[model samples]
Target chain A: MESLQRIDLVGFGSLLAQLQAEGYTLIGPRLEAGTIDYGAIEGPDDLPIGWRDEQSPGRYRTLPRNDRAHFGFNATPASFKTRLHRSEETVLEVQRGEQGELRFVPVIPAVKKQAWIGARSCELAALAIQDRVLKDSADPDPRYAARREGVFIVAVHCGQAGGTCFCTSMNAGPKAEGGFDLALTEILDGPEHHFVVETGSDAGAALLERIPHSQPTAADLRRAADAIEHARATMGRHLDTDGLKTALYAQAQHPGWEEVADRCLACGNCTAACPTCFCSSYEDQVELDGANARRTRHWDSCFNADFTHLAGGPVRASTPARYRQWLTHKLASWHDQFGTSGCVGCGRCITWCPVGIDITAEASRIRQANGEPPK
Target chain B: MPPTGTERPRLAVWKFASCDGCQLTLLDCEDELLALTDRVEIAYFPEASSRMLDGPYDLSLVEGSITTAEEAERIQDVRRQSKQLITIGACASAGGIQALRNFADIESFKRTVYAQPDTIESLATSTPIASQVPVDFELRGCPINKSQLLYVLNQALFGQRPTLPTHSLCGECKRAGVTCVMVAGGTPCLGPVTQAGCGALCPRHNRGCYGCFGPSETANTQALSPHLERLGMDPPALVRIYRTFNAAAPQFQAESQAHERD
Candidate 1:
């Protein structure tokens, strides 16, 4: 039984200030162009307060919330992964020497000590998933590793679930398990509004000691549990993980893929929105001077037609094959490779998909079509 | 791979029926243009240079579409003369805005737009350089990307291969942290079917992509039309978007033509 402490609204501001004092660039949910996505922020004021996000298949919009809760929003398109695993960056720069000898210089980006505030539990799980995908690989991504160094996390337990969320079924959210400096649950009970904070690490305890906080009351504990419970109960989506990887593998030749392919745009939107996807492609840019060149690695997706391009042409020419590759790799092959499912069940893939391609629904449909009974 | 000797490879820039924007994209390279010229000899570029150097060129960048019969014949000779021929921009790769004449009666267009129809002599339809002869590579875009032009030139000069993505512009938008206007704002966007390389210019600025770079490798504009309708895009607007700079592109052309019958 973990005892939780209560931090008042003003104390939340100081917590942000203390993080800044400790040399961390704050990043969290922000309102930008009719949607709330993650980006750099100054402090608690920059948080998307008094706003809730509406997410459905192929649609997303931010609406005003009645209460001043920063973490009321759902999964955003831009995650902590977006900042850590960069889209495109010059990995190596080659300079032509005076004698025509090439000098290959590696470009290691200057990483900022960032405190990602108001991170959802699903996003935190995504960070851990990416650690295995990018860092634990044979050819580890140093760029991602560099950007992720010495970063602090302020996990926000979801008090509200979006229409497309399936974190409860994925067992990734509503309540954060681990891998956070501190975990916070926003409890809004009548006139009382405060964050029930739980220290997850020694660093969290150190920061909490410096901030204004009081021992949580019995009512506060009940409300905090109730808040997380509300999210779990309202979840409108689910992914049955019982034999999911095996079922996805067995449904490789299923016609459901082709049926979905008719609608699949192969735009790589799902891959972009998915926080756990780690596929990438490299582009070599030769300098105009013909003196030096640069090699850049950018995020790539299996959805791209040319993703499987070989010497002759693309191996997976049809949209069905590409979609299958992505789905299978994310759910099935991912387990064989990483020992865990690639999806964190944040539902950004469903919400951000231009045509609303639901991954879990597709998986369920394909499994059933292949004669696999629903769990 | 610097040519056989210390001599720099000869580079030729040709135009057929374009705004010369693609040629200017090379000149627009400015500092990079100087660097490129330093590496390769600019044998003939009527836009920048008056000096005309004859055949057997190492690399040739062909711009615009083959509209006139003379251009149709000339591209064949140019193909024979040059070791490598790379098409630059929509006109050379797909047929440019002039290709709109393809969907309509050219004779009627000539009479309506031009007074002396007999004086003008062109093929019934404006065709790309690839339609005339085999193209080594194609650098996509309406006006073409300067970085890609330089990259293609670098590849041709160094005897290397160019790797240009034919992926959707949605990837570019995602990379830059730009939300999907189609999904988030319900704004009809062609980013899903359009090829990348414009660095997601329009979507980054909070507007829809007009698909100036043409179609992606797996473009499904057929499936996209229904969603565009859901976003409040009318039939004509839907037909019009696909019939833009890259109209002659098979996928967009099929969608635009399909909607035309509807």
Candidate 2:
């Protein structure tokens, strides 16, 4: 049995100084380009402190919180996956010499140990899903695996949930679960700033020991529990995941698919922003010398009608079909392949989607039509 | 004598007259890419390699539609050189977006999308490769799915038939647990006739289908005609859908012609 360890939260400035001195490339949420995005930070001043986010079906905006707190709300537009798993990379590059000897090699960059400071529960769930798909899968992604192995996550509990959030339904969060080195809950106890930190790994314990900190009292544990409970009660969104895969599969003859085709431009913004979508397209290039060759990989979306074209014609040429493929894979068959739901309930797809298509609402509509009770 | 690993089959990727999106699907297999290359020799991919091996190659994966007098002739040569030939995108299996020319006057189309119409020398209709050659298998999409593409490639190399769905996109939607957007929200959709390849995407994103995949087995466009009309789709709009990417396809062509007569 692992014994519970003591961790004291110092002043924001002091905490930042401690991590900085320990050679951690501290990354946290920062307001950039008028949107909440992730960036490398040196201090609490750079964090989106006292900032809260309000997201509707298809809209997102930032607001000021009553108290100056580091993790006042939920997820942002940028997922932690983007920083870890790149959208596109040159996996291999080949150049031909005059001798015409075809020398082929892979393109892998030197990796670095990264410390992520303000990760949320949903984001951690997304990272774990990515790990299963990109690293643990039979065909492991070497580049993603290399970088993922060196990551040390510091999770922050969500005190307020966003409108698009359904992590509670996804069983992913509202509270920081496992898969983190350290979990932090910000508590306001008069003028004295306090954070309840729980060490989850050896790396976390070592880091905690290095900082000047006293053991947390019973009050600290209660404060942490209260924060999580408050966030759960304040959740702004809900999704019905019960029998979700079967509901989608049974609606093959349902008339809803075509209606979406009329409005959807198949722009593929949802897949791009989604943390778990891993489909990609490949390209091959010839060297200037015309002797050697290499291949490149980039993200691909099934939303595009042309994604499945062939020599004589495309098998699925209609926009409705393409749309159907993307949706089914995300919600239904993804379980068959990955043993988990493709969507993490982060709601980034809803917020980033230009057309403002709400997935949870769509799923609910299907259940209603089938005369099933809403989840 | 036992078979050696060196005797394993070779795979080739070819391109025709469309954007390189389909061929790009092969390159996108980053995680398994290095291992895939080790298993098979990339015999002849003009887009991926300049090192071309003279046919007869084991398997040929072709992308794009048949357009221009030269391409019509080149497709025949490709069929002859390969043991097994598979087509990968809308342009290759159906005529593609360029096939919209089948609805309008060809001379007018050449003048609209091109800077120098005279410089463009193409057939009056953009046709799929199967219209000219014998394709062993056909994978459908505007750009084919990477997993399906990989599946087909693996099957061909091992002398097995790939199990791809021939059902409509509606089947996929049902499996995904998405609500019927058309029935519930009164949104127009094309899932009834469109083939299943892409997992249902538009409806999941809270939108309707646009038929990137061509018609499925025994599609009844006539039955859909009234539903589209009730949804306020005009004759021209209905005709436009049939004539866009896979216009030259027999079923879609016949459907569009009927709309024009009406």
Candidate 3:
């Protein structure tokens, strides 16, 4: 059995160096453009140390935590998927030869080995959902599979919760349950600041050997658990998932849909912020000379009129229909399609929505309209 | 391919009352512009090339709006000479920011801007090409996206229908995985009722949609107005919101008019 170890702040930096030496690009949360966005990190200094985020519907602000903690923020609008699955990619390039024969060339992405640090449990859950949708499907997405291959995940158990977070309601966070090579719990007890690290794989155990760390004490374990317990208790939102899919599916004519649609700009901000939304469209481009053509795939949304554009016109011409399709697919139909809910309850969609449309609140309303008791 | 000596399909570009931002987008397609020259002949484009050619052109991409009486007559002539007419950008598709004159008194505008109002001969209302003459296609955007422009050109050349989105901005946001700025931050966005184009630019930057692409198909401005009101927007603010770049568009025009005090 693997044992939990205690690592100091300095030791964490060393681990980052070790990952770099192993030819892994270290990606973690860093303050950029006034928000904590994930990007390449060299060491602990590159992280958003002593910084925290305040998130509410349509509001995101960064503030100084006045602490030495590196991962003080609960979640960032940028998710791991941005690194795993690119926003735009060329799938194929076509050129006509002198003989009039068309030559097609496939565009493949360059290989990049990446290690993600400070991933929260909800993000991990989202990654798992993406794996099933993009990797474990009948026709696996080569682009996603290529980028996702050999990714080293270092998960952080929540010590704090954001104002828009609802991972506890989704049963996906407050603790690093699985899908990580190493799970870290930051324990801040008085003046003592340390981390309890548990290895989930042989590669994680092997990497831990390179860092200066000691076996965790019984008291260290208790503190780690307590920190996660506090995060769960302090979650800002809750979503009752009991018969949620059925309630949503049944409430097609719910008055709340019209109310929500009336407020919806149909701008597609929610799906863009959602970690699990994976719809895309193909764009065909031809050279000015019309000699060569290329087809590129870019992220697309269901809220787009072109998304449902048929020979005659758009099927869901109304904003209400488009909003209905998005909410239903996200909270209800996603279960039928992926055997799981699309939302991990990270609350990114809620936080990033310009109009401050809370999905949890909408779901509760829908459930209530379907004769289901609210939480 | 046609013989080297065979005349290529003639192309022309026209402008009226606009900032020429959409025309700049054509030039902005640096790499694609070189490739585009091989497919279509640049018969006339004052912004790009001074080399002018008489019309009866195969395709004419029109930008801006009909703001003056002379411009209205010129557009009819351009429409008569061109086989296919495609309106590009907010100015051609809607009335653009200049269409703000449609609501207020044009006589006051002429007097305020010009030293002598009698010297200026302008139309009472700024109007889109489709309103003046039949337009084959209308590309929406403050400055129409280069990729969509290319798609329209390619489809037009190949005798195929263009696949432009008439859906709401919400579709782009969903596909891009952008967070809902309205729900999370309580920011008032016009994304739901607005047309999809500009790739959801404002919302991606953690801002609200400004309705640059105008109203989408079946835009529910009636439904969205109350919601904006509930979010603390007063009547005057709502009027201003709908009277932006696409103020002359029927859906937004009616909505703004409904909120107008006088």
Best by DockQ: 1
| Count of backbone collisions within predicted model 3 | 52
lDDT of 3 by residue, B98-151 (tens): 999998899999899999999888888889989999999999999898888888
* Winning model by lDDT: 1
Per-residue accuracy of model 1 over A1-375 as CA lDDT, tens digit each = 454789999989999999999999888888989988888888888888999889899999888988888788888877778888888889999999889899999998777799988888899889999987787778778888888886899999999899999998878997998889998999897789999999888999899999999988889999999999999998868888889888888877888989999999999989988889878888887766667789998899988866778988788878999999988887788889888878888998899889999988899898887677677
Native-to-model Cα distance after best TM-score fit, residue B171 in candidate 3, in Å: 6.7
In order, the Cα lDDT scores of the candidates are 0.87, 0.73, 0.84
Between the candidate structures 2 and 3, which one is better when assessed by TM-score? 3
List DockQ for all candidates: 0.76, 0.03, 0.47
Name the better of 1 and 3 by DockQ: 1
Tell me how much of the true interface, by contacts, candidate 3 captures.
Answer: 0.59
Off by over 4 Å in 1: A1-3, A373-375, B1-6
Model 2 residue A322 distance off true place after TM-score fit, in angstroms: 3.0
Q: Against the true structure, what is each candidate's TM-score?
A: 0.97, 0.60, 0.90
